[model samples]
Target: MATIAPIEYFDEADFDPFVIDDDVFGEIEDPYAIFDRARANGPVQPGTILELLGAPADSIVAGIPQFRVIGHAEVQAVMRNAALFSNDVLKMNLGVTFGDTISAMNPPKHTQVRGLFQSTFMPKQVAKWSETLVDPVVNDLIGRFIGDGRAELVEQFAKRYPFEIIYRQLGLPQRDVQTFHRLAVTLTFNSDYIRYGKEASRKLGVYFQNLLEERRRNPADDLVSLLGQLGGDNGLSDETIVSFFRGLINAAGDTTYRATGCMLMALLENPEQLEAVRQDRSLVPLVLEETLRWNGPIIFTQRMVMQDTELGGVRMPAGAIVNVSMAAANNDPAVHENPRKFDLFRGTKSHFGFGLGPHMCLGQHLARLEMSRALNAILDRLPGLRFDPDMPKPTVKGGLMRTPRDIHVLFDPS
Candidate 1:
């Protein structure tokens, strides 16, 4: 039998911040190192950095118990049981002073606030946005650079699409739009640029506060305008709206940008699969799924335990900071057959891409629609498209959100 070291500590919150150190954060699942150590190690790890950051039990990061990252089922548990695992994550990352939208609201408040956004992001609304918002923008941008025959996907396509779409939806002025885009990106995943993130948040907070005032006086036709005009018991307040804008901007910008890039690259590499879909065109949705499965944009989510529980056979105490290892979970053999292989034709229903249950990505449907449209635009217009096999392969960004930093595709405008 293999000798297992007696675990020195399981409750990460008990440890002093200066003493706690976790190596798991180092093992990011990039394209070069997909699920190397993390998947093999299973879901629960006692010494993760996330748990280590929390204050002692008596002085947690917030007044609430600290949650640690864990495995697929544990992730499923938090996602599934909304009551226990609150989606109000703003409390954890962006303190209440910053903002609190539906994503940060609990139960009754969350449900009501979520509905307001839902009404704006419904299937019909998304479709309308595609027809009215996305297509025109993509066509205009590509038309400008179509003759060039090559462009950096991130700066040109992935970033621009969501930035424009979300900016318009949120009703920010054009002058302020780019700043917000840059700010959103920095706060979400640009960990290297802490000062930029802090400045961006500070500016956006002030900007949104002013915009909220404007909307109150004379609302526009956009979603934010509508949200501002709403009144009653279930309606959101200005502070809550500001929080939503902050979270939504970050969530919208990072996820869609990553999704758009990830899907396009996957389609390029998996040529046979790409060709298979391009031949029929009806398989676009399936292609998106395969792309998400092949290279999920968002890697992990965290949940705090309310009581003593067992996850993946490991007992965890209350206040454990559990990361729903989405990247590892997606590749978990128990869920998807031959997960590493990207078979667009594969028959798989559920995936950890947008996660599952109540907290499942609010912007998923819209993201899918935008990504599908962007890809179709390329496939339809640009023939003879394929990866620049000669160029170095793109690397995936880890932490908070996962995505490729570079996805270079070479093709003739045939």
Candidate 2:
């Protein structure tokens, strides 16, 4: 990794790291409406979702023969048949920004990379972290404004806890939390901000390289130490380790941050549902599943067609870019009754929110554990939590990512 000046400070005035910039890809107030129309046309369409929506195509996938897969079955088919549809599309785009991590690789390599830490992220293991990590971090964040009676949940709590949990798990310095947060966001949308993404990747790579070395000498009980201790024939190179670290920060932060905000916004908009969950804590999982289906953090995922194939009666040629619309599949009326409604009582749990098949989200268990703890903490500490009617109503919007940027609410101080 190229050396850069020590990243000691981040200016707070230039931009708010917690908020997603609409300009990154071009914001759409109702991307789902566009997806619905596209799906209505045909489950598998010739053009990309951007073109179908009349928006500009991302430069990365521009000029390529792109197809939009919208039906639940079609999207599932593409995601499940990794042999026919490869994830190498990410290699050309996210690979440059996130490094050559597991997210960009195919079987064998992807399997091995994911296996190194799969045991750590398993559901059984993640549940154990709630008491040791989630509860304290969540309670401390809530305590910051428990007496204020009103607060901006996004800026104050939702944005902070997810990164804090992941940073602590890696034994990262608490002081550099803001720096890492900024870098993670930049790397995520690197295509939008090319120069900054390159710089952020280099900075984070250097930071991780230094930490890896320290862990090598001191051997602490942390994720970084585990990565550092690997040796013999199966050992990983520093470049791969740094790449995995960069991917970890990128994966561990954004989805949870946006999903938490989305969940709160969903509940705040529907007071009856919020009250129901508060009364029946068992319904908390339903709230999360419904939120993910109604407005998942990731709007879509991309795959490369490996061989000529027909899906939903649409013929796709080899090397075509397939934009699998998860948001569309989740809200498909065929699979979900009254799909648009944010019903916490909805029974069907089938959706591609965390994706499916070989490359399913490895951090899903941890993400769920974090969101569950945060939601429960808010309900317990903030009595009568509801949208601040005097403030602007929060709306979830984005071209690819979906979440309310801010959710102002009022609660009883007592």
Candidate 3:
């Protein structure tokens, strides 16, 4: 479509690696050297958005196609262009992971499949679910060590916290909670599955296949069973239902776990912010909102170019991949005043946390409710809770999904 195919393949030795400034953030990092370089050059300039797609995206290594971690208008443009650049990597990577009716689907299919889960995650549904169930569960979890003034929040609580809650919401038998949790861990943590895509896909397909059958026969009053009923309504195959459940399992399990971890870590790092919220307790909303921006759960998401197109004023071709950096766009100096600073009362409710357009996250309300409940319980109960300096820094394992492994908090429980 352009002078050359936008999805141009340059040999490793072809292009000068010195296109942009040096960034040793990780062994392999895309600080979007070209995009950022263009951004650095002028108001509007030539640049490219690099998305880690297919098996290559799974490889976290030096010299990989990580061009740059981009932000600003260029990044937003990518998020906006859902048509040319798609959320259809599920077919490439996530499809094998999440089945069919996921963010990967576009337009009509996306609308149809996503609707089945809409009622379940509706704001009202989440609210009732919270007061009746979620809140008490969180309170109980936090209340365990209220007097001890200590807890291994991540391992003992945060890690499994979202899983258990999801199980309850999906109506999975309580006993099978641990099994689903392990499956989630494997989906997110076991990098080996990433390399062996077929094996991972088969294993996930099989597990969910069995789970879907059980949910069907029992017909429990839960999300999965509801999904079971909606099976094939709009091309929602049994395979799709299975993947949706497993996808739902893998989707929130780590994001919330790491998000809650990051929230705790950020709170500890800024004592004044923590204290402010502890005193008022109402700042939880603003704090959580800011946290979603500052140390957001999702750093970047990949999309593929279906047809030749222009991105950030540069030509892009069919088969090209674009990686949208929510983190960078979030911290864009032009868009956010004092971008680096965390202001709980910033008053902006929107963010890439749930994504944008037709492919927005379906479980957003549930996630928000869960996080809000946990934050309120934490602030209300553990007034003196703060990060222990000696506490180990939480680490995030990256791939299609990114989340922290451990977030140790040392606080006086009471």
Candidate 4:
């Protein structure tokens, strides 16, 4: 047998964190203030928030046009009305990079493609994975750093956990995890990272193509095999299957890592809440939900106007881009009491963190399982977990996909 060539890894050192301007997305310290001002204007705010970051009105960032929506009701309306507000903005801008992904598809096609993998992520399967996969991954990762007394959770734990789960679930070789991580970050984080994103996309395409062929010849009990078996009857073309895998890999890997990091940061910043959840393990899910509301991994998603429509009393032309700010909606005072506060006791409420409507996140159940397990494991293994006072406190950043840049912390060694 010919030896398979090892995947070339992207050097993390090559990318300078300082080179990316914090202001690229505007004051990361408090974007809620900006969201508040936009909400005040009306439900449907015109112009992209990137303008606040000094981008020109017409410029495209990561293939997204300049438009903004902050109202909770209005954002929900846009998300619900997929027919009027098409989700193919990425396809329109990025060409065929995503193929006919569920995120970029509409109606009958989206329904058909989404149904194929729906069972895989159902609550029952998610629960099985939680016990069999998520718990073990979380525990092992924490075990690696537990004895060190101090660790940067982002690099050491949060980033690696979800990537490993998704890679294994997809039946990809473990050797490619680092490459996938770098590619996922570049694709999801910033528009300035577009060039790298395209390169990553290209590499992933080749990688998936080979994987797809292997799965076709020799099926297995994994996502790639399931997709390969879908065939002609399910309305999934070979190209669509490849794109779906690409989209899944990107979504599954990127969002969970950031969401977990954000949740930890929320707890760390509010030590009282951290202790409350630590003491009462059942509160972990509530804290996770609240973190989604307060600081979701995806700040906003773009929708293109399919026809002339009036939203939030503002007239919009066909083809106009509308930015649906999930972060803003999560903080809407109308729906949430004291929306700005991070209260785990806030109880059940709707949130767009995993998105809403037809294109709602497919991996949300899996994400919730992974986060719940990871957070619970951290608290169990590392008692008295607190931010390292000697090190710089981590701050949430990015206007598009917000998360703590780093999470430096110390825990009781004993």
Candidate 5:
């Protein structure tokens, strides 16, 4: 008889969506140390940081000469000069799963498509949603657990918060939150869980297909309705609209989920900073910015070499896949003083956490709103909020999507 391991016997129930395979890459306790060493040698390194940490490269990028750009300027150079290093390479990777979303497009085409949603995510537009959308979503989530003195926030709040907001914003029923979130998370793990990922993709595609039809017949005040309305005469195709919304879920969902957890964990670790923010709510914005700089969820993003290029005096041949380490660039000593420490007052505001150049994150304002509102709601409601004394101290895991396994915390219930 053929033998199968015990680990392979589990079902979908075993999938802890919050953890999301944080240790699948063999958890690196200090990825910065590796980046520091690589930076000391040169601004650009030969192999990807994940590979250096013992995880093998994805088959798609396996044979490519991978370069890890660590310095702030070098990272900006690559991000800014999208013409030389095209983001279209993701078309072959993420495109296979996400279709031809704008993130995977380059130059003129990218600029054109982004304009469609640019106004929606602008700071002023995003501000309108703060009261109507963001605050209500935050309070609704807090109300669920306000009576409990202790909660594993990663599972109860951080992980669930962003997905709920995203679902509601899309004009989907509140009941579908879990289903959509699971599908989104599974689809993102296409490389690891191919079977589930493909199934998730199929289900999501079919659901959107029907929803698009419904929105066309009877328009509503929802993102899907808005996207549906946009297409018809001189707008977008139904397929492009679906891909755009799919990309939004993939971009705005997991990243915010992980980032929220990271932000909360950072504050818990630094009690004095947490107290300072609690006392003066004005520091909320600074805390959010500092968190993004100190420990952003996304560690790196990939770009393919469009032509022969040299960054930081290192010549990169055409067809090379460059992994720009935003996390490393944020910690570069050249730009930030005492790069390792997390300070709310650091105030230098420039970091590659949200990326740079044309393909920078469009939903950044929305993300900031979600994080800020969530923090404010917590501080206002959860008095004496701190790490649970009996449980294991939470340490952030993973090299890529850095998030704590579970943000276990204790607080005085309202």
Candidate 6:
């Protein structure tokens, strides 16, 4: 296993504290309410209030006229029309944190990078990892807490399990997983605290740079080694490799934990649904999909207009920033009935939980595999799983990436 020395700290004083305002951070107690209002007024609604109130300083829509796409069809149209609505918004806002990633690129470039990375996460590869890597890791995590009558699922299990899986795949030593997790949290979730996020991003860049160099010198059976071997000939520069790794860490570490945490909260809140899944384990996938539709982690995604275009009969100027509200679209009455209700039996439907179009989440398969395995392990190993009555109930919150802050649950001690 390769080991890189950790950076003690990065200077954040030079970093601007507020690139975007707090209101723009989208930290709403009930995003659905805002989405409902937007949808009621029109599928495409002006976002002046959101911009003036709390848009992040780095927000692409900060000074420009902004619009929100709330209707399901409208959101899909915007997502699918990657040419008209480019992903440059992410590049503009998060270039420093994520570098020139696939999410920020368009067309040929996005295709090249995405194609190279896609093989790493192919369905067969993911299934192999699920059986060999995911199952053991989840079982081990459960074993650590099963003796206790109660456990805080977020801190103890939800956060660590998926992160560890990613770390192992990257071939990093087990000792460094927690360190990477800490840096990832600051990079992904602490964007509101720009100074901290910048510092974390800086350190993470250094960490990956060193790791890539190490892999180049001494080959290993890991993603980093595979990427390193690709070299500049394939358009995989050291800087690009480091950036891709940073993006992967952020996606794998941050999104999975939050999404899984939200899933547990959904099941706990709906005891009958929980019991139903427990009775028939096959329903786990449906429950996961429903949780994503009803209360997915990502609230919205921003896109920059590449050319003048019209959506929902409203004309949008080139360079306008559009906020595609996946959460709202998932709940749109025109698409799903009683969209707010969490129903495992809703059957599979289209959702932006993994996003859509060219820049859709690449690690979605891995995420599902980890989630299903974790859910199954908990059900098999920990009998009678239910929320602990003595503990405060967990609630899903956050404007950008929402998940339960904590899930206190009690189960039969095995």
* Full-model lDDT for every candidate: 0.64, 0.82, 0.62, 0.77, 0.79, 0.79
lDDT of 3 by residue, 164-259 (tens): 787777665555555455545444321234433334455556656666677677766677677777775455788767767767877666678767
In model 2, which regions exceed 4 Å deviation?
1-20
Candidate with more favorable, higher TM-score: 2 or 6: 2
lDDT of 4: 0.77
In model 3, the Cα lDDT at residue 168 comes to 78
Give the C-alpha lDDT of model 6.
Answer: 0.79
Per-residue alpha-carbon lDDT of candidate 5 for residues 239-321, written as tens digits (9 for 90 to 100): 77777877788766788878888889888999999999999999998988888888888788899998888888888899999
* Regions of candidate 5 where Cα sits further than 4 Å from its true position: 1-20, 23-26
lDDT of 2: 0.82
Candidate 3 stretches greater than 4 Å from native: 1-69, 188-192, 195-201, 232-235, 389-405
- CA lDDT, candidate 4, residue 354: 87
**What TM-score, computed on C-alpha atoms, does each candidate reach?**
0.83, 0.95, 0.80, 0.92, 0.93, 0.92
In candidate 4, clashing pairs total 0
- The full ranking of all candidates by TM-score, starting with the best, is 2, 5, 6, 4, 1, 3
Q: Please write out the lDDT profile of model 2 over residues 184-266, one tens digit for every residue.
A: 87776745566666777888887888888877777777888876765336656787878888887877777888899999998
- Write candidate 4's Cα lDDT for 1-414 as tens digits: 013355454445486322453533434566777777767678776688655433433344344334688888999999999899987676753434555567788887788778986887899888877766778788889888888899999988887899888887877666767766666555443455555556666677777777777777887878788778876776678778877777777777767888999899889999998998889998988988899998887767788998888988988888888878888899888899888888889884689988999989898898888899899899889998999999999888876666777899999875
Model 3 weakest lDDT span, ten residues long? 17-26
Better of 2 and 3 by TM-score: 2
